[model samples]
Every structure is written in C-alpha cells, then in structure tokens.
Target: MVDLRGIRHPLRPAGHGRLPAPPAVDRVRADGRRRQGLILGWRRRATVAVATVALLAVVGCGSTVSPTPGSSVTAPATSATASGAGPAPTCGPIPPVAPPSGLDQAGWWRDRTFYEVFVRSFADGDGDGIGDLKGLIGKLDYFNDNNVASQTDLGITALWLMPTFPSPSYHGYDVTDYRAVNPDYGSLDDLRELVKEAHRRGIAVILDLPLNHTSDEHPWFVGSKTGTGPYADWYRWSDAPQGNGWQPDGSRFYYAAFGADLPDLNLRNPDVTAEVTADAEFWLGTAGVDGFRLDAAKYLVEDGPTTENTPETHAWWRTFRSAVDAQVPRTLLLGEVWDLPKVSASYVPADLDLTFDFALDTGYVGAAQSGDAATLMRLMTNVTKLYPATSGFGAFLSNHDMNRVATQLDSDPGQLGVAADLLLTGPGVPFVYYGEEIGLTGAKPDERIRTPMRWDASSPAAGFSSGAPWESMSDDPPSLNVADESASNSSLLSRYRNLIHLRQLHPALSSGTWAPVASDSSSVVAALRVAPTETALVLTNVSTEPVSPTLSLESSPLCGRPAVFGAYGQTVTIGPELTAAGGFHDYRPVATLQPQSTVVILLGP
Candidate 1:
C-alpha cells in the first residue's frame, strides 16, 4: 500500500464499520471484451483491485471528498487484510453470485406507468410548504385522474422519486446514508405507506439508485482518514492521489466523470458488492418497490458516450439484472440508453427488457417541426432497418430528461397530431408522459419541460399542490393545460386519449410486427402493423396540406389467406381496394394527407 503522512482521526462507514467485499469489477472487462489496440480500449483495464490506505483514511477521517472532473476511477482500493481477519465480519451467510436467470427482479413494474417526481419540489403537506412524500400522498387522486385513458387509469405504474435520501443538495444524488430517509420528505414510515398505498391502488414504486458515489460527509471517507474505522476498502482509492483518481490529499485516489464529491465505489470489493446487492434486495423484498429506472447506465462499462458498443457496460448490467432477480423475481429494468438504435440494442440483454427509441424522438422531432412529411416517412423507412424486431423498445415523444415534444416541434400542435398518430401506431411499447396529453412546453434549460401535471393550469398549483410551485411555466390557455382540452372535443389532450384508447381497441396495434407497404414517396405514408389476429393500416402525413395515397396490402404469413391487417402481410390476403401498383378508388388513392396532419385506418379481417 502507498504510504502517506499520517493524519490521526477516527472515522468509519456510515452503516457497517467494515464493508463486505464488493462484487468483482474484474468481471466487467471479462464479459465485455475490450478490443486490443483501440485507443483507451477498456479490455486492457487492470482487473486487480487497488490496495490502499485511502479507503481507511476516508472511513476514519470524516473528511469531505470532491472528485476531480473527467476522472476515470478504479474503485476497489483497500488491501485484502492478511488472513485471520478478526471475527470474519458480521453481515450474514450471503451465497455466491451466479449468472443471471431470465426472470424478474421485482414485480408490479411490468405494466405500470412510471411517474417521476422531483421530491424537493413536488408538493408540501405541512405548513413548512415544501413538496414532500406526504404531500404527494395527499394528491394521489390527481395522479389517478391523469391516467383516464391508460391501461389501469390509476395513474402511472410506479413513482420514480428523484432522490429522497439525505444529502447537502436539493436533488439527493450526493447520498450521506443509504438507510436514512430524508425527514423533510417524510419519515421512513411515509415511504413505506407510499408504497403500500400505491400498491393498494394497483400502482408500483421505483427509486433513484445512485450507487456510483456518495456525498462528501459520508463517514467511510472520514473513518478511513482516521484510525478508528476499519472499513476503508468500502470505497475506491488510488495508489498516488495524482493518477487517474482525483485526490485532494495528493494521495492516489479513484474518481468518476460526474464529480469528485461522488466518489466511485469499489465494486471489486466483495464487501461492496454484497452491500449493494443487499440494498437492492431490501428495496425489492422489504420496501416493496416495483423496480428501478437505471441512471447513467452509459457511463458504467467504459468511460465514454457510446455504451452498447462496449461489452463491459453490458456485463455490468447483466450483473445487476442477475443480482436483482435472485432477490426478487418479476422486476422491470428500463435503461437510460441514449444512443442510436444499434448501440442502444446492446442494453437489452435478451431478458433485460425495455429501452427508449431515441432515433425517432430526435429525428422525428427535427422532421415534423419543419412540417416535412416526406422526411418523416423516409426516416421511418430508415428505422425499420436499424433496430431488431423482438427487442421491445419504448417509443416516447418527450420525458423529464429531454425537451418537451411541443417545444421540440416548435409549438405547431398539428405536428403533435401526426407525432401522436405515429407514436400510438409505431412498432413498440408507447409511453405517454404526464401533461404531455395537454400540450406542455418550456424553453431550453428552463425546465418547463418537467412542469407539474396541469389538470387545468388555473387550479391550485394547477391542481397539483396548494403551495408555490418550485418551477414556473409559460402561460398559454387553449395551447396549454388539460381542462380546456377536455372541454373541446378537438383538443390535443382529447386526441391523445383517443389515440391511447385506439391502440387498445385494436390488439394489432399493441402486438403486431410492422411492415412498410407503399408511400407517396414524399409527404404521405401508409404501412401495416400486423399481428397474428389483427392488421392495422397506419398512415401519417406531416405537411401543410392533405395528400392521399392508395396503400396496397398483398403479402405476409397468410401466404394467401385474404386477411389485410391484424396479422402479417404474408398471412393476409389482398383486397380489390388495395393493389400492388397504383392504390385504391377503383384503382386510385384514398385521400391526400391533411396538412401538418395524420390518419390511422384499422384494416383487419
């Protein structure tokens, strides 16, 4: 171990005095082969855990840690204590880990709408007037009403609270203690009740798991610095503070790309692995959470923007999936994989399900906003070839992490009509963000993108809370809010509700495989979403004027059955109206697409 000037101080990890050895990080490189000779190829990353006094220093000293920027760290740092390591530690008879089984981690997450709530700024129950869990509890009904057209109508399937644990900052990413619940949010009892009540309502809950690093005040850092703590190996340390690790002590250290305050944990430490594994287990088994929406998944495998290309990252996910399944089965794991369809596909480890399709979200955003239907049609043509059919991707227009679709489409709501038509009619599970049905918009970086659900923008906290909202939004009547939309049969919200209900109306829309028929080649598209039992002819034209195209349906699994949609093109038989050559109308087109508009026709048995 590298020696440093001794600083006498007593410190220890916040929870256990000595952490259990962490699961091995070495396995990451093994599963995801690092290409040799590639610049910074992760395949060559050292597999050995670093042995250091820094973990000891951190746990003992009670010092604050601020990791340096752009730092790539190696986490497992403590030297393995020579044999006879005291009473062999107290944390129970945990079994050895095995490869993942294609089972669930936790239940209730599969078919739920995952609601993400920014805790510090959600709602305030007590006069203290801060949005807390209790406040959210008080307003559950509002959430329920928002899902009127969803599968259950009980609001979202799970509540993804930003971060409710104790930290110096408002957004609890810098965790001080894993077990401690922030009192401001509510007691641990409040969290338990939240889960209980949600479950009672057929809803599930998900929490932000920020295991990557911790706040500076963590006891492990302090105790390791001082002599009283024996758990320094709990966190990653460096041999020389100046190397890859960002160390203020000028002692070797380990760090992450996010920030130094959040020191990367040493997964190489078996104790670390056991602790996190147990934490996930406890949440799934004890806390009764539905599942997790993994954050920063792209950062784990190697240190870069493109994740799926590298195998190490996928291996890390596999480890998490396996560990979670062993504890609780039936859990849902949705990844935040922001990349092209090819790279994003890596995150779906066969059994590990659900990734957002960014190709359409970003590309469609660029095309539709310009009212270019031909471009949108061409992009979809490109999409059919980019991703795999069975991966089950999630198609969304907007989410808390990205720009609002309305804003992205430049507020020309007709674009939303076409976008929603494509969304509900596309080739994957569709997600509808809260308030998106009502048409929410915010300028870049203003966070209006994450505004509260506006049952009506006029209600108290827009019917979300009684206290002042943490963020302000742009005021627009007919263009914003749900109340007006619901009142007007033609409003965007009503249209969305209809679209959602429509998807359900035809099983073909939900379970079918997509096949391109024929397009006008420019501004109009007519394709088929066919299932074993149903065939849906989906059409959209995103332009300033309506243009019709005669779409034809001839082939599929039918091989010649005469079925049009609700099934495969090969399975379905062609009709007189839809021809292989010049489309319908006694051999003419149906109707030109509506200007900046769309239309979906259910053409089945």
Candidate 2:
C-alpha cells in the first residue's frame, strides 16, 4: 500500500482555497447570527422545553462479528412502472428484514454514526463516469466489513444517500419522479441489491426525501400548469406571484422558493399528503430503506414572506412520522433543519428523529482553529440544552451543501482531529460527509463539495471510476487517498475508525447522559459520559500548548483508576480522593493534557 506516514507537513491554517460562504437564505445557512436567531427565535416560538460519550467501548472487547448476509435467492422482479411512458418506476416487494436491534432503532440513532454519499460522485462501478447504486455497493466494505489487512474501515453504521430519484439537476434535489431511481445512476434492482448488501453488513441505508418541492418537469408540476388534472392543485399555484416562490407559467404562477425549477408541493392538500405518504411507504416497505434524510424540512409551510418553522410545518412532520412508523417501526427521519438549535427544536421527537446541528459544527471548528477550549465548551453547554431527552441532533463537520471540512480547517490534521473528537464523543449522532475522513477537500457550486472518493493515488480518476469523473480530483490525492491513509497508522482515516470503534464498544460513549467535565480553565474541554454500567470522561486539549487543568466530576465520583484511550496511544491516569462507600471520589485536582489531543478515561462502575 502507498504510505506517507513519515512525511513532514506544513501547518496550513485556513485559505488553502477560499471556503464558500453559506447560502444567502436564512434557513439553509448556519452562521453565528442565524444561530443567535434560532436561539432567540426559539424562545419566542417555544411550545415546550428540552434536554457520552469509552472503550471495550473503544475496541470490541467480546463483540461478535455479524454474519455476511446471503444474496437474494428468489429471482428479482422486473421494474415496476405506474405508467409505461413515465419516469416513475414503482418498487416491488422487499425481502423480509431480520434487522439487528441495537444500532438501527429509532431512538438509537444518537448512538450510531452515519456517512453521506452523493451517489453521482461516490463510485462508478460500470465505468460510465457516473456513480450508481452498484458502485456504492462496491465501496460498502470500505465503510465496514472489508477486513483488508492494514486498511482501516471507517466503521460508520448508517449510510445517507443524497437524492437518488429521477431529477433534472445534477444534485438530484429537484426530483421529477419520487418513485423512480435515476436511470443514469442505476435501476430499481440495483438499489435493492445495494440495500441488501448494506443490511448484511449491519448498516442502515437512509435515502434523501425532498418532500417540500418537485422538479418543474415533474408530471404533477406539468399538469399544474394546465390546471386540468388531479395534479393541478398538487403544487402551490396563483395568478400572481409572491416572494422567491413565484414561478411563471404561461398565464399562471406557481410557488418555488428555491428556484423556478423546484415548485413547492401543496402540503395543505390531502391528495398531496397521501401521495407523499404512499411514496414514503414504497421506499420503506417495498424498497427496504431503513430511514430518510428529509430535505427542506423547515420550509413546508410559508406565511407570506416567512416560510420556515411554522406550526403547520411541525404538525405535518408529526403526521409524516406516524405514516413512517406504520410502515417500519423505529425507522429514522433525520430532518434537514440547518437552523440553530432553538429554532430547530420545535420539530423534536414529535416531528422528527433528529435535526442537523450546524452551530456545533461551525462553532467547534472555530474553537479548534484558535485552540479555544472555552469557546468550544460554551457552545457545547448551549447545545446540551437544545433538544429533548427522547430526540437527538445530527452533527457533522461538513456536508454536500457546504465546503469540505479539510479545506475549512486549512488542512490542519490536529484541528480536524479535535473536530472529530467533538463529533464522535460529544452528544449527538455524527454524520461524516463522504471522503471527509480522508481529508477530502472541496468548495461550493456544490459539485466541488460532492467530489468523487479518492481510493488510490495513481488511478486515473482516483479509483472512483475508469471513465472521466464528473468533477476533477482535489489537488493532492497522493496525500489523501484511502490506500495511503489506511497504510499509515497516524492518518485521519485511522483516527475516525478508532473513534467510531470506541463509540460502538462503549455504551457510555454512544447513548450515555452528558455532563461537561468541570475544570478551572477552558484550555481543556472535557465531559463525563455516564451510562448504567459504564462511566467515562472524554477530554480534549484545544490549545497549542500542553495544559494541566484542575478537573473534577460534578455529580458522581471516580471509582477506579482511569484507563486512557486516544489517537496517539498515550497513557493517562488521574488521582481522585476515595470516599467511605468506595464508589465516589473527589478529584485530587489537576490533570495534564496534550495539545490538540483527545483522551478518553474509563472511570468504571
């Protein structure tokens, strides 16, 4: 394997390439002011109130390997089509699922880690220059169950595929047919095989569901223009337009807040809601998709100029959740609410399984760049209270819509590692943007952000495809390819694997109650993960210099000697004063921490 472990690297800080600013729209962008708006706005709109993660917890202690699932014994059915000429290909009955209990549960999403892939650029198995479901199937082992020597699998438990439906745009957001897989990507059978293989490996597949809008080319949208079919009222229509949503037809105007091509669906219509419900049922029941990443979740109902986080929007999601629950109990519905926690909190438990936390991502990176533990802790403190006990947040460093994490942190591996630590060990479900684990760098126009996966340094398209890839490889694939990172012990890929493995092995890290580690100063940001049988502390030093902070447990006492776990394989133990009962103890005070390093200590039951 090609290895670059010994190479010395420059401390590149920001400006490697200009990171793209978030979109101008308030809902999509996750800026400080918007987060403040979400916080302040959440208080104004609040109907209710709200709310780590060790080791065998780090590595599998006595974990049993799940058997590889067998291929379909029955012959695959022919493509299902509602209309022979239409692009909407209906799905056939899915094979029965004997789903694993621990990781795939609805409430258990917070305990799992997810990786997002834009299928068009993820992998190209047929050498046709576009990534398809088959290509993604080919790369499933890289996420988990490869067992390749010297290679570190990312160990992500869930896969979030960006919109795979028939759409006019490259991003697949403006869907023309919700029931059909894009012909360019693959066929319905190909998706079935991918899901089967993913399930076999114990990974849940989450498809992107764009419920708010449809392509102008969609049959429903077309019928709406004529105002002469059942679909005439499927989309919001008006003789006169308003705000950003008024798209001009021959004589009438339709609502399309995103653009003229994406007309917002009329959620107020029962027929529209029924269609959506049936569409979701097809994917969950017939296609066997484990969950969904609901797109434009916050913009379902607009009030004049205000079209975000409305009461009707929240109620509709509750209804949507009920439909999903009927089909597949405990199926995940991860909402794409890029707004701040306060504003996003309105949809928790009742409306969604989770909401994306952009503030945690941006704030953590900002703190890591400056090595400011205090700021990171402050952000975490606020975030810890943003959700209900039954619901969780979706946390990530970068995504398909934004600049890649490596570029945002200026390619600093240390800062990136700290960011990963915060995501993996902190309180929320973590979603890794495809190729982010290997330091894949890209910026906006979205195509760059959704660049192809780098498998090998020498492959023509970095082993993503034999044909010309849709986007060019990032400037330095030699240093970032999976093969190179897998060979190196000290690679970002390795760190991600270790962290995920730790999360899986330790219940405390995955689903435990969270409390920040009390320290005198903010140089060291730490938290205690208290589970029923497991107790551990996750500590990170964000500063450039070593820190020896006075640390103590806020609630329970340290019962035993701390067992250290971290990226660099360091040994750490802190002394605590023993109480008479032998279980509780007070910290003797200070513990030394390494710069830009994370340490997990097992405090014991």
Candidate 3:
C-alpha cells in the first residue's frame, strides 16, 4: 500500500510555485487571501497529475451518482424538433447585467453569502405586529454585520426579501396588485429607502417576486369577471372545459391553478408577460434594486391541471428572460424552480441565471438526517457536473415554504453543521434563511413559517416585536438563539460566518471547478476542485462512526500543486510523491472534519 506517513516533503510549501496572482485584480480574491495571484494551477494540461486525475476520475466520480431532477443517468440530448423548432429564438441585444454602479451582478456573486429575510418575521419598525421593509432597513447592519455578511467591512452584496408585493395574505405570496406596495409593510418609499441604504453599503438587493398566482380578491380577477380592462386576458378564462383552466363564470368561466381563490394569470398572454416584466423592471429600473428572486417559476405556464414542467413553459421563460435582460442587463434573475436539474438548467441558455438547488438540498438533508455522509460528499460531485458552467446556483438549507432543516433532522445541531458546510463551502451561492443563523424553528401554522428575526437572544420578544409577537422563537430558546450561539465557534452562526469568510478568502472554493477524490467506501465523502486561485480537498463524515477512508489525489487537481485550501479534522499525514495513509480515525479530525461535519482544507497554492 502507498504509505502517506512513510513519505517526506523534500520541499517547503513556498517552494511549490512561483506563479503570481492575476495581474488584473486590485482586491484579494478567495481562500484567506486579500490579494491573490490572478492565475494559478493547471497552466499546462498535459501533465502527470492531470492525466492521473482523468484515470482516477472513472472511479472517483460515479456516473450513477444521480441528481433529484434526474438520476446521474445522462438524459439524451433533445432534438430541436422535439422541443418544437419554430424560430431560432432571436433575442435583441440587451445591456449586460453589469449596471453602471459597478456592482458586478454576475461576477459579484462568484463569491457572496446570500441572506434570506422573511419580511413579516424579521425586525418590526412601527411596533405593529407585522415585520416591514423599514424593520429590515433597521436590521441592515445585522445583514451588513460582519457576523452575517462576512463583509461588514464592505457591507452585504445582496439581500433576498421574501415576497414583498402588495397582498392581503400574511406571507404576501397572494399578490393583490403588482403595481402597489403593501401598506402593512410600509410605503413604496420605505422599500426605496431599504434599497438605497443597501446600495450605499455596497450591497445589492433582490426582492421575492411571486408570479404564480394571485389572491382571489386581486382586482384583476374582479375585472376579468366582466372581461374588461387591459387585464381581461390576464386571468385564464375558459369557454370550454378542456383542462384545469376552466371555472364557472357569469355565463361561462375560467380556471385558476390554485383553488378558485387564486386566479392563475395567463402567462400565454403577451400582455401578461409584458406587465410582469414591467413590474420587475420597476424594481430595478426605478427603484435601483439589484435583481429578483422569482417565485414558482416552474409552475408558470404548466401543462393543463398537473404542475408539469414543459418546453412550452420554457418558451414563456425565454420571453420573460429576454425582457428582463433588456431592461436591467446586469441584474440577477434567481428562479424558485425547486425541482429537477436538466429541466432547471434548460432555463440557463434562455437567460435565467440561477435557481434553488432543491435537488442538492433534498439529497443533502436526507444524507445528514440519516447520518449518511456519503450523500453529502456526493452532492458537490453531482451538481458540479450537472449545472451549466456559466450559471449561478443558490444553495440553502431551508426556506419559508418547506419544513425547517433542523426540524427534519430531529433538531440535531451536528447534522445542521454538516448541512451548513455543504451549502456555504461546497459550491454555488450560499443562502441563509432569515432566523437560521439563530436556531429558530416553526413550520406552517396559519402563522408564518418564517419566525420573526431575533436580534438579542435574551431579550423578551426575541427583539422581533414589542407586541405579543406573531409566533414563538423555537421553544428551545436558550439553545437556539443568537445570544447563546454567536460566540461559540461551534454555534451555527459562527460556523456559517467562518465558512463564509473562508469562502471569501479562498479562491478555489469560490468559483472553482470541482473534482471528486476516490475513497475506499462511498460512505465517507471526499472530493477536490481547482478553485479560482488554489486547489483543495472537501471532506464530510455523514455517519457517526469514525470513517477511515483511503483517499487519493488521482481524482483531483491537487496532486501536483504545492499549496491547497481547506480545514481538516483529527490528523492526516501528507506523504511526499502524493500518497495518504491511515485515513482519519474515529472522531479524529481527519483534516479537522468533526464526525458529521463539513471541512475544506487547502493543500496547494
């Protein structure tokens, strides 16, 4: 056997490479770096390490390591005629996503930590029972706070507010008027202030744009009842009961995807598309906002009654994407197409930049809860291959619609730690749910799944509201709140911040191309990637047992590199000539990766 401990490093870490960082960047890139070499690693493709990595790739990376959207089985490339070859979609040349502010919407996110704010549950400004934009404005510092954004020095780069449009419902997903702002959440000016404040802090803001369905009480529904106004076609009406789009009207009727209470807009109608596009444009064009978090993107233009994802629906998205790109070139377009991989990635070339990696979230959480670290390890390897090279993906543990991740895993903090590691360090953009940093938990209760944001752990009302408060912070207050967890590096908040900052410091983990490392058992997870500036190893022990894995650099770009990036658990020996032995033992930080933990260790420069 190749003995790692038996070998010796004849050269020091500094002796590895003389290549300096990119000559372009004025600021530091990633991997504990403030200023980094612009270009590093893999300058020459024809090398022993690269060749070996390709050979080991077959064993290290499994083609069967499927995704929730589609099993690892590669779907056959669809024919143009199959998707309906009408016209080679001609898109007008739109401005780039880079707005004059130099916000770097696309590149800016290459290394960013996303914070999800449920407005109604965040900070309360007016002492009213509900949370508002002003409340969020007050907590900008919390977001801008170094502890959360990792760049308190520079302020947050982006803020994703839960659905903020005018609505009668508590969560606000049931939009009443697209043009108006909810009075309960403050006025349009309030939203403008929040956006302005965030921008001044060098941050860009993204509001949740729910376009799937509208409240039954929405004015458009009332207008459609008479088949009048510029919105008659906005509501899907039915002359014949053909599919799910039919309902009883005065003489005839229409169908609403949701119950009769929610009338689905006919996105097939160009006017409807124009209006929705205009609404989004209003936020970016007039409000100076950065981008949008599109809700229920898959549900739009669904096939008949069932919520199926179809290529026609994809056509609708293409139209919408063309409009947005034209209006705000550098703006972010994040869709909530919480479903499959291929279907989701299809929206990319159409111009939809990113979407929720529900596939990874589901698979990651399942692995964590069951203590199957193997799945956690498979996550990065699978998605890194499936997702488009140019697209940005949002990684989150839990959000408003689903059960809190903690609730699913029996509230096990250790497992939660593993989940955080997967999202923050693994790949793509990392998003932290509103009260996630603080251990808040509560599922759908006619009450908001989004519990109010708690500023002080000990303060009564959890600093969310002076009024009796809309919901309870987890009953396990002492254990979950920020006060108890912030200082504890082991606490969720600290772990998230550490990973966030580390992600910012290391270029490899940030915007890096991933490669999985081959191990003896598929049970213990291990992988590698060539990050923006460095090479590193990512390891996670899904199970409780001490997993001693035989790791080889044959699958990663790390073999020949001198320096790498990552954090380890227990202890490991790095043998000269690149051999590792006695894989980390029980609970020993094989690279400081705590059992049921996520650890990224940098190896070469």
Query: Whole-model Cα lDDT per candidate?
Result: 0.52, 0.68, 0.58
Model 2 lDDT, full chain set:
0.68
For candidate 2, the per-residue lDDT at 190 reads: 92
| Residue range with the least summed lDDT across 10 consecutive positions in model 1 | 47-56
Q: Positional deviation of 283 in candidate 1, in angstroms? A: 1.7
* Of 1 and 3, the candidate ranking higher by lDDT: 3
- Of the two candidates 2 and 3, the one with more favorable TM-score, higher being better, is 2
What are the per-residue Cα lDDT tens digits for candidate 2 across 256-368? Answer: 88988888999989899989989998998777988899998999987778899888899899888888798788788989898887877667767898898888888778877
In model 1, the runs with Cα more than 4 Å from the true position are: 1-115, 119-129, 137-161, 220-231, 239-252, 301-310, 373-391, 444-448, 457-460, 473-479, 552-554, 558-589
Residue 433 miss distance in model 1 (angstroms): 3.4
What C-alpha lDDT does candidate 1 achieve relative to the native structure? 0.52
Model 3, 329-394: lDDT tens digits are 777788887767666655664547787788878877777778765665566666766675422577
**Segments in model 2 whose C-alpha atoms lie over 4 Å from true places:** 1-100, 103-106, 146-151, 557-568, 578-591
Model 2 TM: 0.80
Tell me the TM-score of model 3.
0.77
Clashes of each: 90, 8, 54
Clashes (candidate 1): 90
